[model samples]
Target: MTTCRLCGSSNLASVVDLGATPPCERFLTSEQLDEEEPSFPLHLRVCTSCWLAQIPPLITPEETFTEYAYFSSYSRSWVDHAKSFVDAAVDRLALGRDSFVVEVASNDGYLLKHVVQQGIRCLGIEPSRNVGEAARAEGVPTSTTFLSESSGSEVRDGHGPADLVVANNVYAHIPDIVGFTKGLRALVADDGWVSIEVQHLLTLINNVQYDTIYHEHFQYYTVESARNALDSGGLSLVDVELLDTHGGSIRLWARPREVTGEQSARMVDVLEKEKAAGLHELSGYADFSANVTRVRLDLLRFLVAMEEAGKSVVGYGAPGKGNTLLNHCGIRTDLLPYTVDRNPYKHGRFTPGTRIPVLPPERIAADRPDYVLVLPWNLKAEIMTQLSYVAEWGGKLVFPIPRLEIVEVNS
Candidate 1:
């Protein structure tokens, strides 16, 4: 993009060009395999002025989220994480049965179900019709629409202002950062808390998690940039918490500017940490592109050596991040014959660009593949426990990001 999506600055610098890949979630049906798949440039650029890392908004949110393939409830750890967050939020915010909660991009009611059980009134604003229906079926009051300023205002008007607004792993998904933030501000009460959990740019760069970069995530954020983004919507950053989810993420606690209190010590400490990492300057990103190349090379070498050794390597999850890693490393079915996912929607489909077949999780044990490459490595603990049965067949698990490592699972 010529200008930064958040700051409107014309100055932008390259972080890494992952070459071109299809929309990560655009899985293909057998009937459409003969048709040409569409691809777009997957380049990440940082706006020096605002220090916000972003990709060109080649695909709209509607195209990706309208009939989304990702169902959040598939991951047991994530569900447990959501439940923990709900419990903590209720306690921290002194929420009760009379309190109202709103969650943006609430997928399949994974989180709001906990809110429901607490006897609190809650609404989920999810864009995907399929997942939205699933949420409704589970008794979550959901409105299927993208969060814009208008929609957020309408929700607030219809249901009254939320006592707590929770947006998890979705702050970076929208191209219009300012408008989305405004929508978040619109949905929350003037004195209510807004809690957002997003992948921290500090962790993304330091850990070389380039695989998370896709057309769907238009921007990345450090606490500095996130604070600025929140300010644009009249929300002031109050507290911050470093989380282990999605490799590394930051949970930002914010409030309306008028009611915002002094910055929490935790927020101040995180900002200092970002400064120590040089995230506020261009130097922190200097080694990122080279590090990304190293990771791609390392993973490719492992896969190729496995192939030459006559060892079968299949993927564990067909997540969006996995598609980026596969497409970037130029891996086809020859290297990874197929991958399995718990999501039924992807069982018969092929991963975008890579075109590797997706099967059910049972196939891993049934086929007894020599190695199961764990694609969604962020949930390593949970996945390893579930696939510990692989040890029965002398199968090992492979993790690609943060570094390439193969582990022997104990039964």
Candidate 2:
């Protein structure tokens, strides 16, 4: 029986059963590709008690993250997004050399590096040893340890309380949700603020973004559930902004519940929208499974048609979401010859379950595929621009999620 992680309630409503899927980032070597791969049920559950939507962390964090495959700095668009966030955050907070910034799960210091460039004091708490070490080498003060109430207090004792804490796309991956968020509470100063960005659950359902559901992600949060999770850690919402990244995301600004602050209009506005969409009830999940099934069938038809048309198809990025899509749709190198990625770590490896060979981005031109299926559709604009030369040979770009469609862009 599945139970809600936060409230300890047994009333879990099944949202979508995604069969069994391997952990998304487990890119294999050629030799290991022949080895048997283990997979777990990709079932998602929503708590009728607290209305928190989550999937169990079927694999251990040590198994999933120690020597990680994903490095955040590889995506130029994502890096620029981080830099822009830094500029706005520094100015909005009136931060300077006097303020301290702590970023949890600061992958390769992608965001904190910008914080350091501005001469602000910054610390990165990264669990992935390789990624954390890389962050330190890049001159972002990084600690290679998981954040918890005890460890967070130790960090505060050594470096003093943080003035601003940033956590983007990290909370969902956590298994011990309450403990970790409580740690975030302990890490910040009384007057300090915490900013968290997570993909909105409402958007996931509407867009049929089941591909975003993988073993690494333990929970898919809505505004209501997110607020409750933060409140459990003694935090209260101060502001929120809806972002278009990762399909769709919500940026929440929170402060300690003890520190009085008025809720921003945007935060309240989003909360109402979430409520109107029935996010607080189990009915919000009714159509989710049906939508996901329709998407799977639609994607298969598109790929099959393109192959029969004598067109060569290759994938653009080997993101975790890409693995989910490929594995669920059961596409292999037969349907898609190969895929390319900018990160050198993934260059010689094969994607997890599908075992598609991954190559360097430069290989695309030589292979000269007719249709470049962008696996990481969230960053399609940046990728399409970088590979605009594909249009020179009459190649087209295709997006696999939201719908299977060919997107027209500048060559």
Candidate 3:
């Protein structure tokens, strides 16, 4: 972390230090709980030279994604979002049955399945074998490997240039920003489009979404920084769209540098918004660290008060972000005994440093806890609807980030 990953600059300023925590997704089995766990410095810094906010690459992608625990299809809303993106991309790119589409980090074929249904040629480059197998089971032609400059070229050679390359929610996972970007360039055709969806730094700061900061996400991006990163790999940013996913995100439309045209109006508007927010400079990040502290304090206070009031509290989701929040706030099983998730992969495992048991979603109804702390608050609407039956026992839902609020559920 001595030099910026994007730009080789010694000048890096602290954005926030989440303290030392294990890789967010490293859920432990009962046997591993007795063993000592390893943690790393989870500090985030911003490069003054290029304005890219990043964390040290303490853990490699191989360590995290090889046996991934997260499956995108588990979240109904996310699957729907992926389907919408596929429909929109096909129409926008004028794709047809003859067109070829490729998606990077295509977990469980949640997206490419839509492309397959339309009789288009599609492939998924997923690193995780288990999830990749799941994708194959669903009829997605998947290549199990990490995406890099060389790998990207190989894919292009084997499958021919993709008409469209889709990377969703994975732009930040790679430590080698330049190489991954080049890999993206290699997978796409000279005239084909590359669409990437990543969490927007502007919204992250504005909304106090600090939990999204974890080891897997090597860097965070503003549209300005993203444009620079894209140019490094010979890809040109053509347009941008604001998305409400992952707290807040931006969908970047890019193309090979040779065929790139005038930047779209939406791209210009977003850059203007970034400049107005002072994101192009260091001022925009000045208040973020302090805001993060306030969130920690507020959440801790609520959990402690709930304990004192004899109200039983449990977690709703055991997502990676939830682990970050749980560890940063020093929450343990004493406060949150267990959390539930829809994914069966995590049913019997425990959350990485917190050691809270992960149970099935039905456990919530069986126990009828007084309060359910909803993690993965980005899916607030979907989760609220799923847990509407909580009202049967006058149970309430609690959200930790941005602020602590308790909402009574009504069936």
Candidate 4:
């Protein structure tokens, strides 16, 4: 029986099932691709007790993220987002040289660099050795270890409690979430703040972002669930921001429950919004499976029609989200041919389950495929701007989520 990760309730219900898929970010080499690949069932189970949407136990953290391929610095928009967050955090906290900052899952030092530039002491806690090495090379002091109570206490004891603890897009990657949160309390100062950014469950359902459901992502959070997780871990949410990054996300600020500060009005407002959207009710999630099936059929039809018309289709971005979409839809190289990404780590690697060869962005111009499927649909605007040349050849850019639609490129 699959019990809820948040509340330990066996009253878990499966809302969206993508069948079985390999680790979404496990891009394969030529040799690995030739060998048989392993896959696990991908299903989002909602906890009736707490409303946290989570994937049933499939793979461990070491299997999903230890030798991670995804890096934060590669995306210009993501770096900018991090910089903006750093700016806001510095200003909001009135942080200066005396303040210490730490970021968990700090891939490639993208955000901490901005913090360090402000003359504040910054440290990164990242599990991936390769990514930690890159962060350290860039002058960001990073520790390559999984965040737990012991590691968090070690960090606190070694460098003192952090004035600001940041965890962005990482809360979902953890398997033992309670331990992860308890570790946050250990790392944070009494008066310091804890900020987390998670892809909101409300946004995921309303946007039909089923592609975000993968092995690497364990739990999706609504405001209530987010609050529950924080409270359980000995923290309290004080403020919140609904952001548009990663399709849609929620940036939450938390502090130790003992802190006497009143909750921010915006946080209350967001909670009310979630309540109005029926996030606490099972009825809110009942239709997601149907929507997932609809998109799958719609995407299949689009791919089939394009292929029938002798159209050559290529993909942009070898993101884990793309892998989920591809593998779940049973799309293979025969349909996609090859995909392009700017990240060199994934350039020569094949996508996990489908085995689609990833090439450089230059391949789009060389091959001039009839259609370019924008796999990372959330970054469509940025990608479309970069691949504007595709329009010159009468090729249309395709966005696969929320419905597959051809986008207009500037002349």
Candidate 5:
């Protein structure tokens, strides 16, 4: 039985099934890929008890990100986001020179560079060796190992309890969600805080973002479900914020159970909303499969029409969601000429299953395709702004999910 990762409920309903897919980061060389790359089941199910959306068991952190291909320094907007986050956190927590901040899955020290610039002592725990090296290059101290109970113990011995621990878009990535949170308990100092930003389940359902379903993201979180997980790990949520980043996300602030303060009204507000929306009810997941079916049809129809029109469609950002959407919709090189990524690690490789070639963003500009499909719909605004020059040649940008629409940008 595929039990709920959070509540251990055995009742799980299969929602969206994206059949065997390669890990999103495993972009393969043309020669190696032609020899037949492996793919795994990409099925997602919502636990009836906790409403935690997750994929069927497959892959591990070591399998997904250890020799990771992604580097945060590639994205200009992301670097800005990281810098702003450091500023916001330092002020919000009244952190000073004496304070120490630790970031889990702190890819390439994107955020901590700014923390260090502010003269705040910071440490990054990154599992991916390549990205960890990049963080080290940026002068941000990093530990290149998975953050778990054992790793947390080692971290505590060296850095003591951390004043602030930041986990951005990482809560959903681990298979052992409980053990991961328990590690937080062992590492955080008294009066310390943990802030985790996860793609919201509410947004997933409403937007029909079934493409976000993949093995790397082992669990989808709702405010209520996350609170339950934290409670089990001996922590309390002191605040919660709705962030516009990552399509839609919830930033949760937590501290140890014994620590008490007036809980942020935002936290109570989100909890009440989740309850009212039936996130805590068993029946909430029943209709999600139907919604996913509709999304698949809508996307396939759009792609077929674009192909028939002889319009060259290219994809932007080789994100996990793009992989699911492409594999689920049966899109191949016939429909997509190639996809571009800003990350050099993804260059010179083909996307798994579909075998669409991954190229640098300049390829899109140089080719001047009629339509550039925005794959990472969450960052459509950021991408559109970056590629605004596409409009100079009268090219239009298209978004496939949640209905297809074309918007023009002034160069």
Candidate 6:
């Protein structure tokens, strides 16, 4: 029986089943193109007792994220978001040259660039070799390995404890979440803070973002669920902020018990709202499966209809979220011939499982397909603005989540 990763509860219900899919970021090279991509069941379940949304245990960290193809610097909007985060963190913590900042899963030194500019001693822990190497090339001191109890102990011995420990959009990627949190306690100073930014589960469920359900994201965390995970490792959440990034996210500030601070009023308000909204109830998750099925059917119908009309359809953003949607909906090259991505590493490769070739964004401008399906719906606005030329050809952009709808360029 599969048990809850946090509370060890075996009581769970299958909320949405995404079938089998390959890891979204694992684009295949030309040499590896002949090999069949590995796929595993993409099932999401909610613990009836703990309200924790999680995927089944299948892939390990070593199998999923070592030679990662994604880089944070590729997205202009994501870079802007990271810069804003660094600015706020510096201001809130009153950090200076004496302060030390440690970032977990710090891909490509995007955020650390801002921290280092302030002359603060900053170190990054990135597990992916490709991304870590890129960060090193940019003068960001990065360690390429997973952060667990042993690694955290070594870090404490060498650099003492950190003044600020930041993790951006990475808390959900861990499998042994309990061990990860315990490691955070080891690396944090008594009066220091550990800030974590995660995609909020409530927002995802409300927005019908079934595409985010992938194996890479092992857990979907709510504030209540997060508090339990933190308390399990002797950490306490002191503040929380609702962020606009990642569609909707939460930035949580935590500290050891020795440091006392009032819980943010906004945090309390959101927690109470969640409690009232039945987040702690099992029935709240029951309807998600139906929504997932509806999304798949609608997207497939739209694609088949476009094909019948002789309108070529292409995809934008070869992100993990997009991969989940594609593979779950059984989308192959028959429906989407190719996808455009700005990430150089992913260029000239095929998306895992579906095998859709990924080319540079210039393909969108050159081919000007009749329909451009914005896969990463979270960045629909950013992508729409970038590919506005599609409108000149009487083409419309299709957003395939929540619902499949094509909107005019100015609409």
**For each candidate, what TM-score against the reference?**
0.99, 0.98, 0.99, 0.98, 0.96, 0.97
In candidate 1, which residue ranges exceed 4 Å CA deviation?
none
Encode model 1's per-residue lDDT on 11-66: one tens digit a residue. Answer: 99988999999999999999989999999999998889988999999999999999
Question: Higher-TM-score candidate among 3 and 6?
Answer: 3
List ranges where model 4 is wrong by over 4 Å: none
lDDT of each: 0.94, 0.89, 0.94, 0.90, 0.84, 0.86
- Decoy 4 TM-score against native: 0.98
Residues 1-411 of candidate 4: C-alpha lDDT, one tens digit per residue: 378888899888888878899988888998796798998998788888988889976788887668889888988889999999999888989999999999999999999999878889989999999999999999999999999988999999999999999999999999788999999999999988999999988889988999999988999999889999999889999888999998999999999888948888988998888888777988888888999888899989988998989989999998989989999899998788999999999888899988899999998898888889999899877788898998888888989788878886874
RMSD of each: 0.8, 1.1, 0.7, 1.0, 1.5, 1.5
List residue ranges in candidate 5 displaced over 4 A: none
Superposition error at 323 for model 2 (Å): 0.7
- Candidate 3, residues 196-272, lDDT tens digits: the string is 99999999999999999999999999999999999999999999999999999999999999998999999999999
* lDDT for each residue of candidate 5 in 154-198, tens digit (9 for 90 to 100): 898998889999999899999888789988877889778998989
lDDT of 2 by residue, 1-411 (tens): 368998899999899988898899999998897799999889999998888888887787778878899999998988998998889889898999999999999989999999999999999999899999899999999998888999999999999999999999998989888898889998999999899999999899888889999999999898888888998888888898999889899998999899949889888899898888888887778998898888889878878987899778898999999999999899998799899999999988999889999999999899888888999988867887888998778888888788887866567
lDDT of 4: 0.90
Per-residue lDDT for 116 in model 6?
Answer: 83
Model 3 steric clash pairs: none
- Which has the better lDDT: candidate 3, or candidate 6? 3
Tell me which of candidates 3 and 4 scores higher on TM-score: 3
Q: Which ten residues in a row have the lowest lDDT in candidate 6?
A: 277-286
Evaluate residue 330 in candidate 4 and report its C-alpha lDDT on the 0 to 100 scale: 93
Backbone clashes in model 5, listed as residue pairs: none
